[model samples]
Target: MHDWLDEEDDALITTALELMEEQRKEQNKTAARGQRAPGAGGPQYSG
Candidate 1:
């Protein structure tokens, strides 16, 4: 029973790690596209 529980926990951890990696990659892609226009309300400095 202990072994089974450990296996389940390992699987869940692995899945969570994979999902995080995917999200990171997606964010990098979006960032590479560059920031949105100031008028779009993305981010701007009002100097």
Candidate 2:
């Protein structure tokens, strides 16, 4: 039972890490595309 739990925990961790990495890649692609477009909105600073 302990071994099975360990395996499940590892699988969950791996999946979470993979999802985070995919999100990072998508964010980078979006930023790059925004940079290429004309008149992209300037950064808004909130105090």
Candidate 3:
């Protein structure tokens, strides 16, 4: 645990957190758009 983080350190941490949040939002959007049923397969098991 760090008791004291300078202004520069704090700013970098804040910016990184914000960037991660944005990337997560973008990924969620992409996943939501791809929730359709899967395509048919050739064969699962052939006896």
Q: Please give, for residues 1-47, the per-residue lDDT of candidate 1 as tens digits.
A: 48999999999999999999998777655555545532343332222
lDDT of each: 0.67, 0.72, 0.62
- lDDT tens digits, residue span 1-47, model 2: 48999999999999999999998777666666666773463442222
Highest lDDT scorer: 2
Span of 10 residues, lowest total lDDT, candidate 3: 38-47
The runs of at least 3 residues in candidate 3 whose Cα sits more than 4 Å from the true structure, single-residue gaps closed, are 1-5, 37-47
Ranking by lDDT: 2, 1, 3
* TM-score on alpha carbons, each prediction: 0.67, 0.66, 0.61
The runs of at least 3 residues in candidate 1 whose Cα sits more than 4 Å from the true structure, single-residue gaps closed, are 35-47
- Model 2: residue 13 alpha-carbon error in angstroms: 0.5
- Clash number for model 2? 0
At residue 43, give the lDDT of candidate 2: 40
What stretches of model 2 exceed 4 Å from their correct place? 37-47
